[model samples]
Target: MKEKWESYPSSIRLLAIAAIIFSTGMACIWPLVTIYIHDYLGKPLTVAGFLLLLNQGAFLIGSVAGGMLFDRWGKMRTIILSSAGIIAMSTSLGFTDDFTLYTIFFLLNGLFYGTLSPVINALAVVLWPEGGRKGLNMIYVAQNAGVAAGSALGGVLASVSFAWTFFGNAITQVIVLVLFAVMLPRYVKSLALKPQSPEMPAQEAGKAEMLLSQPAPAKKVVWGALLMLCAGLLISWIVYVQWTTVLSAYMQSLGISLRQYSFLWTINGGLILFGQPLIAWVISRFARTLKAQMLLGSYVFVLSMLILSQTTSYTGFVAAMFVMTLGEMLVWPAVPAVAAEYTPEGQEGFIQGLVSGTGSAGRMLGPLLGAFIFQTFQAEGLLYIMAGLALLSVLFFALHSSFQKGSHRVPVQTAEKL
Candidate 1:
């Protein structure tokens, strides 16, 4: 276990730390923003929902722009520019009571925030080409840790004064900027200028050999797979967002307390931190191929939704959540790593950005769709819908098939294979 943690390069390790800190600050506002805007500010839920959509919409644009900048200029330059812009914008909009000002601030913040996230993921690709899945999984763990930390703290501060939540977000973003400023030239810049090695861990050596043995498929085939994967990822996230939006009302309808509902996320985050390394190791040991790992996760995701559709007891919900967390941990990291693998080397930042953009697309749409379903038909209805969507996602992933050895590999005489 210790060795597994130690396997990632220092760049990825620092990137994970940066992700945790960034997510911590983000969580400070994300989980509470709707409640504060709707309940405290006396806006309708619809208004709150639209604002959330606007933020994500802006974020999607930022993600695309950021990725292009990363590829064209360089990672360090793009990261510094994006981070500094976000900091400056957020600071200027400090502690505003005006709803219009708040809305604009959120839109701008989302754009800059969107840019930063993909760049960070791109950095992971640059730092650990061989350990793609492990690098992303570690970053995912750090992000969840930040979520757990910030959620708990945000609740406390929001109760005292809402201003503190924004203050917390701004201050932490400043710290992120500082870290990047200090570390970029020495770490990220050096990695970028040096050529990347295609080495794999011993356990994955056979699969790597097989990939090299085969004839490279057409570039069109590689791109088609990535596009489909992006669509599948978007669908998965739409269902995932239910846990934040409509799930609260679902729990309350079942006579579950808010505290109990919150505890489910606590369990979700705790399990990821402790269980992710072992899960990553298992994937490396057995799954090896990205397709197999994603298939395993997609099936688990379907199972989780099916469980949610029927369970009335608290224990059943907890069990379902555990399964759901496992599914996400398996699927999310694998997607980006595979995207990196399929990407045509120099365009990695753009590819990862496209992946992040799809995620933002889901976040933008999920809440609106989820809220409508929840209010119209309630928990059972919503769960059923989610289960069906997840099933489709599973099918979407099955389209291109596995990255297994033997037939999966093209003959090396033809060209290099993924």
Candidate 2:
């Protein structure tokens, strides 16, 4: 196992480690924000939602900027700069008992952290160009492992004082920054000016052949499919973002403590961590197509939200979360992997930026929309809204799937033309 692990590229491991550390710190704060704003600061739920919208809006811009930076500045600089920014934000947040300061720093944190996310993902693709969707899943699992760690810690610390969560986030990110500064530059320098391996030519050639062989109609179909997938992904993100927003408030209203609320996120992270590899195995063995796996997962999302609407207890919430986790395990990584399949040469990071941006847009919308429904219509209304979003996502994904089927069929003459 050690030998096999060592055989993987250094960049792959570094990116995975960065993902874990970054996401761990991020998870510590996100769930705490809504609770902190409403419970501790005595702000309205709408205020919390607006704050998150600010954060996510900044995040959206950062994601797009980060992709351009990843392409221009390269991995080492991108990682270091973003890491330093996060340290600054986290340090400020630790001492920020004031609402205005917290909101500003929080928004800055999202922007910086958004810059960080794409760099990690882009580096993964660069390092493992041939590993396909499976490689993305492995990185996704690493991130979820961090989420599990952070969520569990956040729950325990929030029980004591929410300040601890902020402090802890800073500490973890600082450690990550130190590791990157010490290790990454040298690793990158070692990779510099190296010639491509002989086998890579054949692999790249095969990829070109695959792309060239696709019928024009198929290419157009795939482009349409990508647009539809992005739409569905945005809808799904709106629902998923609620786990940290309105859902937290709703669950707590039923007598669930802060710790329990945090634990639910922990459960989500654990399932994603342990479940992704298993889901990948099943998809490879059975689903046979990325779209098929995605569609199947979307249906599960619909069911999870429906179940969530009727939940009246912690136990019921847990059950709903489990179902939601299953859907996430299936869908989350697949989106990027699907986007990767459509990416052209010299534009890898940019395409991924679009994918990340769509998700952020949905997340930006989620808190505001969720808070409105939660505050105006109450808990029952929020559930209905959740279900409706899930169904909308399903419709979009189904359209993508329909187009994908058209792409799969090739004329005999077209095959011969290749």
Candidate 3:
């Protein structure tokens, strides 16, 4: 772990830290949105639901818009503007009491929040072009850490006053905004002055570098590959989110306590934070290619679904959760890393935005779909159907791989370490 941390450039490390801080702030709002709307504002559950939908939809639009702006407006400027927007909206939310005004601020907050992710991802890829999945993986870990931290902190803050949660969120973002202003401008200037080479020698190249060594695919082909990759990602997220939605209710129906169900997430977060070294070692040794690692993850997802279908005991559910977490670790980071590899020279932010937006869309759709299936067919049926959905994602990935024409194998000795 120390070796990997040291291997990353200072820029990549800063980006990961920024992700942690930024995500921590955002995470504080997500868990409380429904409760705040329904309980405090005297709104109906359906109204809360509709507002959540609007927030997500706005975020999706913001993601794409942010990407376009990144390509046009420059990276540092785009990031600062996005951060400013988040700060403004979140600060307004802290003081606003009217539900109508609160809803407007929430949607704007989602919009500005959406812009940050793609730019950060595109920045990571550019900052550490030779790091393969490691750079993005580091960001992923940091975001999860932020989520865990923010969730716990938010719970405590809400106990005192709900206003505190928004204030706390805004405070974190303000720190991030300052950090970006002070630390990131130099990095972005360096990027402008020192453009990345599109190709590298095979003897020292990693997956990202090796892909860069190939002839740049035409714009249309790049979009096609991205679409295929996004299709798989969309399905993968849909299958993965069941653990929080239908699967949660199903476990409680089976007499598992809510505390135990919640503990499963605790286990999930703990393992992700602590288990990376071993997972990194395994990947470095065996699944060296991005495609291979993601395929392995997809299989693991299938295994998790199968395990869920047959299990009623708490122990069985725990085992399934473990498997599911492992699967996500492989697939989630790899998708964007792979997309980074194929991104056109001027379109990095746009490509990453599409990937982020697609995942957002899946997240928005997953609960509704999962709930419908669980209601219509029950637990076992939902499991089998989701397993099939996971399998379908595999086919999408395979199709994506096929789209990479003229690809060739490079020697193992040439590859960079994970």
lDDT of 1 by residue, 152-257 (tens): 8888878888888877788888888877777666774565456324665765877766767655666666667776788789988998888877887778888999
Question: Can you write out model 2's per-residue Cα lDDT over 119-141, one digit (the tens) per residue?
Answer: 66665665566666767776888
Off-target runs (Cα >4 Å) in candidate 2 are 1-8, 35-45, 95-98, 154-164, 181-225, 248-263, 309-315, 371-385, 401-418
172-208 per-residue lDDT for model 3 (tens digits): 9889888878776687667666634556665555766
What does the lDDT come to for candidate 1? Answer: 0.79
The models' CA-based lDDT, in order, is: 0.79, 0.76, 0.84
Q: TM-scores for all candidates?
A: 0.86, 0.79, 0.90
lDDT of 1 at 359: 91
Residue 26 of model 1: what lDDT? 85
C-alpha lDDT of residue 90 in model 2: 86
RMSD of each: 5.7, 6.4, 5.5
Better of 1 and 2 by lDDT: 1
